[model samples]
Target: MKKSIIYSLIIFLFVLLAGCEKDEPMGYKGRPGVYFNGNEFSYSFAENPWKDIDTVLLPILLTGDLEDYDRKVKAIVVSDSTTATGDMYELLEGTIKAGEETGYVPVVVNSVEELEKSVVRVRVQIVENEYFKELDLVYPACNFTFTAQIIKPYNWSQLEYFFGPYSTGWWKFIMEKLGRTSLPYWDMWSPIPNPDESKYNMSYYEMSNIQQMIRLELADYNKHSTTGPMKHDDGEYAGKEIVVPAPW
Candidate 1:
């Protein structure tokens, strides 16, 4: 009889442990959280002729499991620190779509003559809500700047191989020759392809004539010389001859 009781107790304890294990399911049990991709970004409209509206897409990251339904991720514009008037920019609420861990906050800028005259600043903060719990991140509240200045492109480092060296004068010349304001690029390591870059990126094969044209233009400038053969007037290549490598 004592052995029977001991066996029954052992069964009861096993069932209780099994129930406890079932209570703690397999997937994430943490609270949903989100944060900005980075702290700052800057852009210029110096060569952009977007006289109506343009968008600057900023990325956001999520923690915890993705939901089956779309979730709202809000960015509040900090007007006190922003220099762009309400009329100059609109902050679009970001979204982490169903089953997605990433999203974008679309900051819309109204291209007016004002943006071409001076630098415009906009700041934003990511706020937590019921959908997303308060994360320790000092997220979003990111810095954005728009200006008339023709700052060097961010991808200039990788493009250094193609364009030789950087100089503002040469940069402008290259852009004019390329007949485009922005040179979009794709990272070899990106997990998914960026649609814009896939569609618009200039192929190396297409650059043969363009490179020849640049040399021709520089030669023409020297041929009609007021100043000697064109040397880069600014940047690291300043005082050095302006040259874009002939296509291979």
Candidate 2:
């Protein structure tokens, strides 16, 4: 009877240990929880957002296709009396998503007269790949961070402070008008894959050409708009701050 009882206890202990192991299950994978500003937010990561089997070198393939794919990275913003911190999105899992690269910077406006505090956070889960053995493979989590600031309408001096001195063309004009009478809208942007660079021969000249074109377009528009009366009259303008939506 004593031997039988001991055997039963040993079996029960094994079962209990097995159940605990299953609960946490090592490795990254499955539905991930995300939070923003102390609020529960919705999000999704790569379908195969894991590199457990091998280091991914090809175009980072999301779990779902591009169009059918919907992923939300959580972000936040905070402000105090003297300064305001822009948004900071966190990259806590894997490499940044393919085609979309985001950078987060603290916005400085006019000698720090007007500033705010902000932060953005994100989370992702990765699963083991069955194709390779653990000895020869490495898994990496992919994630990203983003930041933004509210450019106030009354601070004209902040215009130069935000973009820097080299931006003297249309950027300056836009910033000035935006600061005086309009809410300045900032689009956290990044260059996408250029077809020529991807398929054909890539050259620095080609990249420079594209950037110049964008600058010229913006400069021309600013010149035209400011040329009109009632537009630059007050060295100020009335406009709304339009924040660009993040492409997840």
Candidate 3:
């Protein structure tokens, strides 16, 4: 009889707790949101001079409960970052259409003649609205660097340490000396185990030798140069002398 009574009390407590839980209100309130998904970007007209403008589509994330209606992701170029507006670039509205989750913000960058001498930059950011909210993120901003100079050559990364900064005139000079349409390049897998690429591939030592040749040529050219030190004819390094460092 005592055990039965104890079991009845336990059942009653469970029922009472269930009733309380049913009557209580929620303590936390929440809403659906969207987030910034932009990344660092840099472009150069050196690769494609004929193209006057380029559009970079930055991605954004939609969050919370999925709805069956179109939504807009608002973008802002927060003034804290080097914000470029007007002719430099144009930011378009991002959209997540009905029944769809992915969206993008389009930025149209206009080419400027001045870009041949310097780079223009703009930092884009997003804001929260009735449809979406910002996610907590460190380094929430993505930086962009736009220029007309040639992007660093893929093969010249290691050699660049000795070669100072890249210069359009300097690179052209190397090609002229080598009498090749394209300079040799190599990665871990190439020209070693693979013998087919031997004609086009170059070793670090070979690349170093090429650097020495350019240095010696530049030194000789400068010694006899009556027009003064040979400076770059065009590009971001224009008016700057082409200085190739000695072999390490």
Candidate 4:
């Protein structure tokens, strides 16, 4: 009876070990430490860029209607983060289609660190559809602004830091550089010493510098999204336009 009991315990232990190993993949990284909107994101880029690494750094935004589906809209946003400067992120925005009122948005970021060099990139895209017929009205021309804010862990604190050093005369120096403004304050992100001081007072040079950086980053999107001229409706319903029934 003692021998039988020992053999049974050993079998149970072996079965438990095997069951645990079988459920897990070969090389799981476990849970990530940090999370965005409650979803954990791995900083490592296990999958390499399928094309030239530079191609991934460019900002891109694309929007177009589906050929056959009048009620569907498609949008694509892409950005590359493997550049020399340690900044990576992108955002795409445009009008949504009218029909089912369904849409999707995607955000992507890539991080790379080799020796002393580091790079981070972010990209975001939103797709949406709306049913105009349900409202018993024609599709009105509307503009929706979609914005994606890409924040690199390192540079994320720069804006605050620039404003943090208020005593060293750096603020005045920055104001001179940026052409300091007392009204509309300055950049929305710029910190203010007090709220009662409704106007923003800071270096215009610094504000301009930040603005320039933003513009340069976004310029890439316009260049990459188009491959060639697309077929657009001239006036009447051509192959591109599908007129929906008035009463449906």
The TM-scores, one per candidate, come to: 0.67, 0.21, 0.48, 0.21
lDDT of each: 0.73, 0.29, 0.64, 0.30
For candidate 1, the lDDT comes to: 0.73
Show the colliding residue pairs in model 1: 124-141, 125-141
Q: Candidate 4: where is the Cα deviation over 4 Å?
A: 26-75, 78-123, 126-154, 158-248
Error of 4 at 153 (Å): 10
Badly placed stretches (over 4 Å) of model 2 are 1-124, 129-139, 143-202, 227-248
6-70 per-residue lDDT for model 4 (tens digits):
99999999999999988865332331111011111212232222211211111111222222243
Candidate 1 residue lDDT tens string, 59-104: 6788888789999887788878889888888899888889988877
Residue runs of model 3 more than 4 Å from their true location after superposition: 1-30, 83-85, 138-140, 152-248
In terms of lDDT, which candidate is stronger, 1 or 4?
1
Q: Which stretch of 10 consecutive residues in model 1 shows the poorest summed lDDT?
A: 191-200
Off by over 4 Å in 1: 1-29, 154-161, 164-167, 188-248
**Local accuracy of candidate 2 as per-residue lDDT tens digits, 100-165:** 332111111121212123423332223333311121122122232212232222112222233322
Q: Which prediction has the highest TM-score against the true structure?
A: 1
Give the per-residue lDDT digits (tens) of candidate 3, residues 1-248.
99999999999999999998977643212455555454565566664567799775555555555678988877777566764547777778877778765566667778877777777677877676667654454334556667676654433544464565676677667667777534545544432221124433667677777778778888888899899888877767788877776566
Model 2 scores worst on lDDT over the 10 consecutive residues at: 38-47
